[model samples]
Target: MAWMYLVIGGLMEVLWAIGLKYSDGFSHPLISVLTIIGIVTSFYFFSRALKYLPVGTAYAIFTGLGAAGTAIIGMVYLGESISYIKLFFILLLISSIVGLKLNAKVEA
Candidate 1:
């Protein structure tokens, strides 16, 4: 359950990040509002996950998921540059996140 919350939070983090891009420097009213909601919602979920997960491990995975998801979305949806080096690091970051999850000591 905590992991689920963490994943949701991470996904929302990705969403808000992309939202920021589409918000046109917060000039687009609807996108900007949605982005603000995303920010609050993501933090809500992240706070829920912190109840059962270590701060360091949860934070690392949370930010890692956000980073990886945003990068992938940028390339696929936003037509950003894709390079071998970028792919390599994204994979590395993902693997590291999984490793942290595997070794994490859940409090409940």
Candidate 2:
């Protein structure tokens, strides 16, 4: 359950990130409002997960998903380049996130 919340938070992080891109430095009213909403919702879920998960583990996973998801979205929808180097690093980030999840032990 905690992991689920964490994952949702991470996805919200991605939405907020993309929202920021469209917000034009907050000059765009609708996008900016949605971005703010995303931010609040993301943090709410993140905090909920933190009640059960280790701070460091949860935070790393949260931000890692956000970073990787944002990059992929940018490439797919925003005309961002997907070079070998970028792909390699994105994979590395994903690998590290997986590694952290595998190593994390939930408190009993």
Error of 2 at 103 (Å): 1.1
Q: Write the per-residue lDDT of candidate 2 for residues 1-108, one digit (tens) a residue.
A: 888999999999999999999999999999999999999999999999998889999999999999999999999999999999999999999999999889987765
Error of 1 at 19 (Å): 0.6
Against the true structure, candidate 2 reaches a TM-score of 0.96
- The stretch of ten residues in a row with the least summed lDDT in candidate 1 is 71-80
State each candidate's clash count. Answer: 0, 0
TM-score of each: 0.97, 0.96
lDDT of 1 at 44: 99
Q: Model 2, 78: alpha-carbon shift in Å?
A: 0.7
